[model samples]
Target: MSNIDIRHAHSLPPEQARQAVQDVADKLADRFGMVTGWSGNTLNFSRSGVDGHINVAPSELHVTAKLGFLLSTMKGPIEAEIRRVLDERFT
Candidate 1:
């Protein structure tokens, strides 16, 4: 019943970053049972008892991922997945 928020900074344009987020979301949608959709510069989804949101602005990619699970439970894997997705998109 608690939440954790994360913010990321990117060097890409908002539109591009939003697309990247959408791509990641698309890959994660059905399997994870999250509604992966884009609205403006934001991508939002929730699944596996967690809420995942990403916002893209010019030069920034902000992420807010939260789960009712303990931090120790979801932190590492989620962070790693985000890193992998970003690397695939932006690098």
Candidate 2:
């Protein structure tokens, strides 16, 4: 398995940051065919070959995902897309 862990800091307040993360999570779930569940401020999501969590906090969002071997080689593009979306949304 391969792992992707990224945490980005933001200046948005807790509520706004939470909403932003939730929106991103929803979009990701739709695009990736992920199933998600939430536990307080954290969203847990998974698909056939991936498992991850998005942790929302007052000043940051942390995303961590593990990919199965077949998908691991595409990690670069996956990470880039994630970074692009995060930058567009939070920066």
Candidate 3:
């Protein structure tokens, strides 16, 4: 399995940070057919070949994911998109 881990610092307050995380979750769900649910500050998500969570903290957002064999080959582009989205929302 291949992994993706990304972190971004955010200046927003907790509530707004969470809202920002949710916004990203919503986009992921819409674009990738990912099913997402929140457990406290961590949002869990899963779909074929992909599984991960978005963690919302006071000062930053962290995303961790594992990609299956076939998807693993696409890691570079996937990480790029994830970073792009995180940067767009958090920074």
Return the top candidate by TM-score.
3
Candidate 2, 1-91: lDDT as tens digits? 8999999888898788878877887887788888988899898988988999988877788999999998899999999998898899887
Question: TM per model?
Answer: 0.75, 0.91, 0.94
- Model 2 scores a TM of 0.91
Reference-based lDDT, each prediction: 0.71, 0.88, 0.90
The alpha-carbon deviation from the true structure for residue 67 of candidate 3, after best TM-score superposition, in angstroms, is 0.6
Q: After TM-score superposition, what is the CA distance of residue 5 in candidate 1 from its true location, in Å?
A: 3.9
lDDT of 3 by residue, 33-84 (tens): 9999999999999999999998988888889999999999999999999888
Q: Where is model 2 poorest over a 10-residue stretch in terms of lDDT?
A: 17-26
What TM-score, to 2 decimals, does candidate 3 have? 0.94
The segments of candidate 1 whose C-alpha lies over 4 angstroms from its true place after superposition are 1-4, 70-72
What digit string (tens of lDDT, one per residue) describes model 1 on residues 10-43? 7776667766777777778756767776677678
Candidate numbers sorted by lDDT from highest down: 3, 2, 1
The best candidate in terms of lDDT? 3
